[model samples]
Target: QPQNVIEKIVQRYAVNLPTPSHKVAQGDFVSIQPEHVMTHDNTAAVMSKFQSIGAARFNNPQQAVFTLDHDVQNKSEKNLTKYRSIAAFAQSHGVDFYPAGRGIGHQILIEEGYAFPYVMTVASDSHSNMYGGIGALGTPIVRTDAAAIWATGRTWWQIPPVANVKLLNTLPEGVTGKDIIVALCGLFNNDEVLNTAIEFTGKEGIAALSVDERLTIANMTTEWGALAGVFPVDEVTIKWLRDRAVYLARTQNRKHERINDERIQDLVRNPLLSDSDANYAKHLTLDLATLTPHVSGPNSVKHATPLTTLEQQRIKINKAYLLSCVNSRASDLRAAANVLKGRKVADGVEFYIAAASSEVQKDVEKSGDWDTLLRAGARPLPAGCGPCIGLGVGLLQDGEVGISATNRNSKGRMGAPTAQAYLSSPAVVAASAVSGYICGPQSLHPTNPISKTFAAFHAHPQSPIITYTDNATQTPPAKSAPADVIPGFDGTLRGEILFCDADNLNTDGIYPGKYTYQDDMSPERMAQVAMENYDPGFTKVAKKVRVNDILISGFNFGTGSSREQAATALLYAGFRAVLAGSFSETFKRNAINNGLIVLEAPQLVSDLRKAFKGGEEVLTRRTGWDATVDLVGGSVGVGERRYKVPPVGRAAQELIVEGGLENWVKNRIAA
Candidate 1:
């Protein structure tokens, strides 16, 4: 545990004695303590299960933070009722809660000082990795495990193998972090970082970036299929925090406090640098000089194309959004605002700007960017996660195309299933808003680099109007250990194979976030729509199947978002196991925690794909293929031919046998 930042942090909070191998490498199971656990609107659904288990009260309510973000506006009476239930739960439980309009949970963590270096926090959102920019271990977990954290201050974690991404040189003007991450996705193709922890190194390259820029890189790490994205805490981080503190004091009209060099330094652990002799599973070098404005188009973040060539493709769009945790910081907003200044949006284009937080929103108003954007016909949305989860305005119509700053452009992700969405930097999105098509920032102004104007726009941005309140006491909560269960695979599992292709099937494709507001929802209700976007008739197939039915998919299966409901819905739909080439770290965890086993069967998956005529190209035309999964023998069967299935590991196997983490904990506590 000496060489890597992840191992060091894990060792500090780990409840079990560390194994010798865990010291240098990864893939070891350990239980660790989380400083805080964050949940959003999904808390209501999780609380239902927590209560069903007869847990009297949350063990440490102060460490639990809940926010109303996903369905902030409550489009229906059912949605409103769910919000009321969430509010009631927070009030009655004595936990900290942020109501609607409070901004995205990730933004709230930074502005409110909840995230810090060496801190181990977990959120239900996959973008929880966004906090890794500040050097915290903010990993994603399922809602069921989140509920377990409410009862016990600790949870189990598998120490992921580490990889290092070294930025070789500083990025030139006009090229931003968004471009760097998109390039990485295109290069690595999602599967490379599956279940791996990525530490971005190179002090010179990282130091050149602003805090917002660093955050943008970390935010998209989830899209790269990484377990977490970490940037070392340094002088730049210290300065950003101090400046933010000063801004908060000025806007809140309070005495200068809450942030200082000494206080910030105390939060970090000793030996901040990764050990010189540390081992890395993989090492990659990225030269920023080669980077340019890039955009990921139509259906996947991995399908990136350089913006210089986008015009030749003539990709006109109906909407452009400059928002989301990926690019909604003050610096990011200013860069976009500078592009929109004195320029009108194209006649048919709908431009939308949403500040990541109320603090950023206030900064936009103070800097006069709000008026500038309004004059350019950009609609200023509320400060929550507006339209990122397809919750608010800017949902695309059928066959419409939208270019957005938000991460993940999976099909049916933003609006109608047939709508096409693309991802890019806010500056590119702002310029595209004007051109009514995909274009780079250089297209906006022939004479100026976009970076040159960011400072001028950033000049007036500062201060939050809200007051900070500390609910958690200085004393750490006493640990409540979960029962040690190490169960093995017990029986034969057979099912029809549900074929899904690799490289970009996200959680949204599994269980769409847009239907989160539907009334009287249940596992069955969700099952009907499970994988509807990917395979239109999957629900019908699932309904006709018996228990232990299987789903076979290509690489990076379940690659986007961290909605536990994705696993829950599939389980309800009668899927007992998912055999795929690989899976996103969060999705794999969610599936296991819910008792739906996820087996890594690379060859079986490849053969499953080849069973069809055009292979992956014909994924949409998939009909059911039968496969018998023999977990007891560590292999799967298709027409009497057996192929090895990757071991589920002792910890994951234990959880699967116990019917998920919830059942394991429930039975242990009862015993």
Candidate 2:
């Protein structure tokens, strides 16, 4: 059976399969033990779950990587305590740890060589797709999945439908990988590749892209609603590995044996590629030459427009940012510096810049790009995920218009929901800052033309490598006995339906980014803020609902971020089940792991929408149609109509009855 890159990678890592052929198809669920699993500041929460699963020690310490990137700017005692807990947990478990200010966890994995060609890496972050830049199959998993891997060194993942994207022509000058992705999001705003894996081809065009460019494009595939966006392992990839090996060896004073040419050549000789006869669910062709500088705006990544269109709109900007795991690499920084070389940011535009990692910061500093940005009135922030995840300074104030290089601009993600944010490349961000409006690099009118060539690696790195080894010989602790009765789940459930008639209702709107790092938050508090971003009065209406009430929404519910809290918050808010037209795969998994019932009933959702005629009355009166869900029968009865839905599998029913994957794993360990 011929396979694409994603399928091939899955086959390499899949374990405990039933067949000796080791063949898998799309939509097939298989157990996999990935080469690496990454978690950021959420490590604290994941650590709590790991311990709760009755696992005192890591099953495989080498497979776990912890980094403290998010919420690094919050020096509050609570944040510090949480960071300390993460550090202590990593040390005691013999896991590799990167302290705060190291960089975004995804980038750290790449810079340190953990995410290389042909490897399978999963992070508890939606942007883990960035690893595909170097030919790795990277995807996101919820935190519970992370905990399961820590306890058992394995978890199940479904192979998503794969899409093949072929690049036809080289990008024109001043166009970037960011522009290409923004264009894709804007043009294909109809969820063309939703929940699908993407494989990029076109030998000439792909070979023309730099590693940083590839990373930018692959990173934003999350915004495009793809599970993974992988590029081919060609000479560009092999050369990057060679350069990275040299840079790491020289800066860390590591022995060459750690990453030598012989090892690299082994990968080069046996490159990972899709078979010529491989099947793809969808095919898309993009001409890079036809693309221009583009920006995705205000509150949605799908609302993309060319720079010229935005310039004509004369959208004024009060805040500008060049940061995030997506576009803060060395090449992106240099691109911005090229535009800001002899220019100053326009008055009233507060520009901020942050490198993807501290090492990237050092690299740009050596190339003089760092000082150039500083002299151009740009404030330098710590080398962490500042302002990108809605933390730290430079957040957009209410009614302010901002332009950023971050991957997402979902409502209330960067600041107040009323604030407007536009996403673009680093050059566009710099130019917009200089013009005090949304524009491109051509607006700067620099003496020298912008340089297209960017150095792949700079050798001014300084970070201590830390590793912990667990040598304890203590006996494994006994697991608690399984519960006699599983709560909240039965053959039949009845509840009032709460309707939210909006498509692509993102995770940020469901749980809000402001409370993402609050590990100590109680379920009561989570319920209070549930859907606060989407509807400010949601909690008020939810408060009047009975326990086990059902929630119904439009298509693509829970579309953004890999935060499990999106589902857990609704669970805490008394929603026993969520029925939507469709679901984001990660959100569905997260809900299932947390024991929240999720169902797909497009016709039912449409019928409900027609019956309620927009849900305004439902919200005002605190009343809606009642629903009776029959799990065994796979039918939902609302009002006088009955709709058929996919039956819940026995495995899923067992997990829901057992109160989630954590409890199920605990019972299995005890058995």
Candidate 3:
């Protein structure tokens, strides 16, 4: 049971445990502790529905949380309606709703006492697994689970077979958490072990990373089809948490009550580690000493290759972006800024910087390091799911190229369908910003980099003024921006109903099985499930393969799960776009990231009831736009229209072609 011994033991006993099944029901199942179960503004829409259906309090409010980090600055009545209502819901139901400006969800969760070691958690959002930094299990759940959890605090889940990641030594210079994960994406991408648990241990783990760095690797577990990620939270973790508490007490709300210390004294004051005898489904040690700057993605996150493996001379980066819950830590920002401190961004490349937490942003701004980045030609943007999501900066245009600090670089994820994205660390993003192509962190950032935390992010570029919506009334979908129009194609339209319609949909609804073990992203298999999962009739209605389909909705559509696979499933189903009454922030961004159009169609539900006559051709405002239908009765739309519905920039369009960052890197290497 010693740390080194666990690896060999797990390897020998792997076959005895559940040998990587996508789905399993445990009769003698141990109650795997919930790592996390979260909801944010996005999932609040579904909660509204749950309430309407006569659902009252959640079974266990302590297990639930709500964060208003998004759209919080707007004092508008509509925004306030949604934000305030969710807050009220949390207050009424005894759930936690972190105040706006508290920073992103996962960051706050760790700072405010939620995530810890040896626990399993699922969220309505994808990145919830970030808690793995503290050795917790984190997973993204679909809308089906969302509803069930909304009514009842618990939902069913099969304990994922574990994947042991053995770390043998310290990380190499300029190599980091980002490289480790991207490398794994390439190394363990086969279907044999998808949707597994990844546990890291060894002297290598002890030496290489800080708790924050571990979170970076943990955040992207979803891309690996992981149920959650875990690392032993040691003294280092406990210290960071306590220091953070002090940091927050002084810098944030001075009056804010510290986490109830008495109740969590052991966790905050002295956290424990996983026993050497701990069980694992699988174990694979990584030689962190050998790791180097690597990049991933021209298509799936699985498309990973070493920096040396890539044909760097042929690659051109149109954009260099730094953002994400993972790498946006202050250490990363300073590393990136230091690299670009005196250098200008490449001539043709657009540069962007995004921080994950407002505190981190404040730290950077207070130090004025942010000014160094801006002076270096990188446009400083507020922290949110930036280029990582389609809504913010670094949007890849069709055939455009980009380098980013995000966790996943899945195809079209930056924006443009043909665009390509490369995933790397902050130092790598900085290096790429200077060189105008994918480059290693060492090329720009040096060893023992200097970092500046505790600056004023809000006062500088001014991160988005988070506006809270006090009410969760369905925001009727409407074209929030003008879209681009393309000439109609000569191909036959797939089905009479270009899309389908429904109310209160989530990404999980669009793609039911993303978290399943197979981790299948195949076009045929995914399209097969698109509408079928919701309404069996969707399979046939979506069958007309030649034409684009559209799906319309009534209200609060696409409410749960940040899985881009949701949009991918719809795209593969021959749907061009999603025309909905409203979309959850994450799902809406996922639509744009995958190159599918998601436009506001408040009027579609009314006019389309009769207009959806089976014989009618459902062409929309955007030609490439596609959608699908739920036979039980619903419609969907995808693709661009006259309105620029939360779009990615020209640079981002270039990254989408490879389907994501890993594939982009692979393609870059091949070329």
Candidate 4:
């Protein structure tokens, strides 16, 4: 019974059940109590949900962390009041809290040692995958999932399938980890690793990548459609822990006993690695030496172009950014400074820079990288998620073409939907800013490009091979009270269909970023702006259709951001269910937690598109195509065509039937 790194870490945190075997494998729904649950500005929304669930005190206060970083630059009384309220809540609950400008929550978690090796951490952010860089098993959960953890200290999660990605050779000078991930996303755009966990191997190549580089690569795996991208805990990881411990002790004047060398050595002695015979759904080998500086957007992460091509295209840029949880560490700042050493930004271009955390900012300032960037005419923003989440200053204006070192460039995420954004490494971004267009650092500095080869293969999915123990008599944990009776699900839903044929319908398109931090938004207000970014006529279509009509979309619906409001907005807009070719895992969980029905039927979606004769409009208002979804029967009926769909598990059905996990947890607490 060989287990991969992800499986091994999951088993360590999995709650024991009364079964013949305690071992866990891929696709098994196991209850887990994670070491930490992080929420940033979204903490306010989670707090509301927690209170709604009748939770007076945290089940494990110390395990929770609240950070205010998303909208740190916002000084509006409303925003400040919300921040104050979050601080008050954290203090009252005895939970760790970081105020605005402290740093992005994800980076703060790493800086403070909350996300350690082999630890299971979940955050209310898609970028939580970044923690996997440090050998931790980190994943994203919806706001409801966060609230559930607060109420009960445990929640159910299905172990995703794993993929093995082996890196060979060392990276070229100009090509950073951001380029490596961007190249992967662009080259493997066909849902190759969608919804799968990834394990990076190849000891020599892993050793060559700095911790900052590893963090950047792992952070963008969210954009690459993977659930997690984990690196092995080798000497590189151990050294980082030791260095961090020393830095903490020297700067904060406090000893961090848990992160000392002895503990780190013990961890390395029992390093977590996939067994030799562990099964992987897919395998990819990358030659890092062959990698070139790449840019991945203009709107989509899947549209990757080598920097040479962009330089040839002479794509002019009006704005440039080097900030986000992904890049903006001290190393990234140094790279940017190296490119902008004695140059100035183009006359018409505006370049903005922000560090990942205040601690990182201090480090760069001490190293003179911060001064070099400022002297190069880069505007300094607060050490937070400035302009990355479409907040604060430096948002792209209409018709602006911008390049960024951030992880995502989805439409309307950083600014105007009509504006275009391209993604690149920090060096490339700085170079582009100086050149007044998109270009790599190589354009300014001479370097020879390396040529190399690699191999990859997709293995057939394998069934889990579990070894059972003879301990069937093990008792499960006792329930505090009897569970209240929840209404039964009929397994049938009927609704008219509203079709949106666009693929990659990101969360930003579903719910605009402007309203994301408005914690006091009512359902009516949410419905009014539902899909406004994607299609302005969406509300009109919703009004014309029946109240419980189903919303249908193309592939990868709800693909960007971990904002649960994306699902809730649709729910409040009267969509009884969402039928799509596929869904983002985070969005699926959010929909399920909010009791919104979600079904996947790719062929059926294509057929419906043909039946409606809908064009390429973002949203189509059709007259017919009524659908009846049968979850238990595992089929969907639209007109006379019957389409097969996977059956929903009982646990998920129970959550939907009970009007979400909040009600389920409430009933359990009451019982």
Candidate 5:
């Protein structure tokens, strides 16, 4: 069937994009100056690098922004210090700062009127991709890259490889993009397609999702290894962008063209279908009818079978949660409520709901959606990111397991380092809330599918908080007397390794401080928070180990949020090396980009765990620790065929000795 509705979406970008091919493909770098650039408090790391590189003044400070959306109202002075540091620097840099009143970076950006259709954008946060809804290419950059652009308004991207996610059949009325993504995750087992650009199309997509719903799905595409997931520009998208004052102001430039209109027309006239002969390392198809509502966990997301198969697993869950960008919309909230309306939650089951925006919360409350949730014993927390960030409400207890709509559930990410949280969609979360165990939407019927939303929560074209600023103090990059700092990490000489053989430990488990960290923190202030996952802080134990002291783990290590703080925690904690049987594709790149040595050996993972004697000598040569890991076999290899663990990319290797992105910039500037 022709995706008549989708043709409209496809036509928009395909036409507006004069050089779509430039934006497509790997190794071929693409360069396009952004209409706007945005950053967060954590982005301070990059700002420092920009300064080191002799960066001063933005092309237009009014267009660039900084905010303290994370770790606001620091609980401890240490955390408070982090915010103060960033705040001080932003003020001096003349970068706009959105006060605490604004929410996350993307939210505040739209609310403040920064995102506009047919424009280009880059952010320090991965979820920046959410901007694609308004018809802009909002993607993340490494701190160093952001700094370079911050100083020069010039940065480069390897034109990304493109994949067409063709949606075939009509979606069931109750279904959503959240459900589709969860199902898609089950199709791709590993991150073999990381850093590629994904474009969704096909007959079933038209009218199947609102632009906001599409934004919610695209927001999480980072987890899928996409550089950006885009849709063609359309009248609906242009309307959304036109609503913003900042957008209107930006377009006031005489040079600005109504590119959106022609692009929309172009897309309709000559669609950019996936090349008939375009080679794809992966091509997958799904039957919307055959997809059952599901939650992934107790194993790989690819292991997500069906809700019916859940009871067979009998994995009892302590809580069921739905919210986050994954499934936080009126439709999602309505779907969950539809299941629990007159029913009482099961014994031993705790249910919680979080709204992505207060706008969604208001809609839910106005319609008495809150009543349904409250009656069903589901707690509705503040609109700010909750367990989706692992900082506050809805965290899992140690040894406890819960089902959630958020992406990536690594060890202790939600709460207790020992606790396991499962990832699924709103329908699955809602159903499991009643069942109090791992199960699917079919287990409850009528509510077997989930609905997703994001951009729509704010129906109005304007948001009150428009910049990433508060008071005018410019915070500097954290600096303490080199001696004043306690040596959380002192490189050891083949020191004894402190090994835990758990596989797939998500970054959430390593840092588990997204909310806390974002609440207004300086890296130093938030430094101790990294160890909060373990009693008395894991750093204490980590510090006892020597340089080259290996921290060995099971398969798929570092599987959660893309925050560099996770690696920061491990690096500061005195460990010098990461030896895992297999690495999550993102974490592997992240570690190398940050200068951490990460080696893989899958079979040896179990043996290494058993071989660990606290402070046990871990010789690089003795353990066969030198190489790439065969993720499946636990074997290590080297050179071009190093399947077990390939050599780090050249650009990544350059980053290693330079300390981090900023330090690297400092050297580049000094030189």
Candidate 6:
């Protein structure tokens, strides 16, 4: 039977079915028993749910990996405690554990050979889709799903449709994989690829990219709101895996063996590929010849602009970073070194480099690529998610501008919400670092000297401080307006509709990661910063509204990051329920788990768009709009028109009645 990559993978791996159907197909709701499940930084949240359910032992310890990557250098006691808890849990359970500063979870998984072709893994991190680079069917799940997997070794999924994109020609010199992807983002943006597995095909494109380059593309699929971005297993993949195994054996003093010749052949013979006649919801063919270096400007991932015209935009940088999972591999460093080998970074600009993994750092050090970067005055930070999710190094001060190789450049991505961030290729970042502005490698002139006058900005008081915080007092969780006592979906809800038209309303934008690390924050405190970047006045608007007010948004709402606070913040702000055109898998689980109602009402969302204006108007409009959400009847009424939409399903409705996942699980334990 002909099938796309998604169907083939889902059919083979799906487990635990209803009596009517054991076989799964596209759009089927099936539970998956993943081969491995990874949780990092958010592992504590998973354990919280697991313990609440009275599960003493995880069902599959050997198949689990716990790591601490986000906020690795704990500034507060709370952050340090979370890391210690995860480390202790791993030791007790006899599961694999990687400590802080080792690497990002997804990158470490690939380096250690857990993300091999045909393997199915689920992680509690949005970038779990990064494993798709190795032809693995990896997807992100919420903390509750991770807990469920811990107890029952299974979690449910709705098999998504495949969006088959064929790359037509070889990439030009100096045009990196990041350039190609950002250009594609300009065309497709986030909405086009929402909940679809993006399968990249065409021999020319696949063959042109190295495994490292492919990883860069795969890592950013989350930004596209893709279920997973996959490349078919080929000779390039086999060679890369073999090379990594040998490298680790030689360098890390670990028990790493090359995949057996027979096993390699078996992998080759049973390669995961999309059938030529595979069904795709959308088919797009992009030629490499038409591509140029591009960047996604500050405040949004989909704002792709060609590098040639960046000078006209006057996008000068206060800092430039070559790090993050998207482009921090050994090959990525080599690309940066090529531009900055002998050139010095501008005086006012702070250029930082961080390797994806410690092993990748060793590889660069051995190759003298690390020395090259240092000679160019690029400060080398520890191997991890350094400053990507606002950890520490190269954190932007308020009003500062930055160009980074990280995936998303939404407002406050690096550190301060007032600062700006732009995403680009490493080569572009290197050249920009030297020139003190956004430019491609070819545009950098050798004779240009470092700027003598530093940019006017307040220097960070604690520049590069890596130590434990002393006297950091913890605060009791502050209570807020109690959840509007929602009776189990007997139906009618009338409230003002807070309309938002932006697709891919990410969690990072909803609740910044910087605040999450503080650990002493109350629900009210989080609510203050809720959607702070998206709308600075959101908290004030939310305060005036009564409990259970309907919050409506565009596609892939609450996408990006697995932090449960994204849902909790809105709940504390007194939102009764959330209605969206669609939602991310993890976001839905987190919302349902945290007692924040999320409903996928496509028809109602469409009707709301027609009623409301687009662009800044959606953010500006406040009142006079009313919505009647009829859960029992499954329709939404605005004025005279009534739009039919399905209610939140049985399981979610039960969660709503129980107040949250914790209450629901506690009730189950008591029963």
Error of 5 at 524 (Å): 27
Q: Write the per-residue lDDT of candidate 4 for residues 212-242, one digit (tens) a residue.
A: 9899999999998998999988888888898
The digit string of per-residue lDDT tens for model 3 on 47-166 reads 754655456556567777787655544557997888877887778878777756666777777766576544455677778768778755566665535544555444333233455666
Candidate 2 lands at a TM-score of 0.78
In candidate 4, stretches whose alpha carbon ends up further than 4 angstroms from where it belongs are 16-20, 445-581, 594-659
Model 1 pairs in collision? 1-23, 247-463
User: Which model, 1 or 2, shows the larger TM-score?
Assistant: 2
| lDDT assessment of candidate 1 | 0.75
What TM-score, to 2 decimals, does candidate 5 have? 0.61
Q: Could you estimate the TM-score for every candidate? A: 0.76, 0.78, 0.61, 0.78, 0.61, 0.75
C-alpha RMSD values across all candidates: 9.5, 10.5, 18.7, 8.5, 13.5, 11.2
Residue lDDT tens for model 6, 1-671: 46777777876776534333344444444557788899888888788879878878877787788878887766689888788888888999998999988888889888776777887888888888888888888888777878877776766565665677778878755567887777777667637777877888888878888888888888888887787898888888888777765666666676564343455668877777767766666666777755666788776887877676675565778999998888999998988887887789998999999999887898899999999999999998888786898887679999999999999887877889999899998888888999898877656654322211111101111111111111112321111111122355545678888877778899988898788778888978988899987888787788887656788888888877878899999888888688888898678778877767776677676766776754546462454678898764456887897765444433445566777766665565555
> All models: lDDT?
0.75, 0.82, 0.59, 0.82, 0.57, 0.75
- Candidate 3: 10-residue stretch with minimal lDDT: 463-472
lDDT of 2 at 210: 91
Model 5 agreement with the true structure over 241-304: per-residue lDDT tens digits: 4443334345464322333345435534653343444433233455564444455665245555
Which pairs clash in the backbone of model 2? none
Of 2 and 5, the candidate ranking higher by lDDT: 2
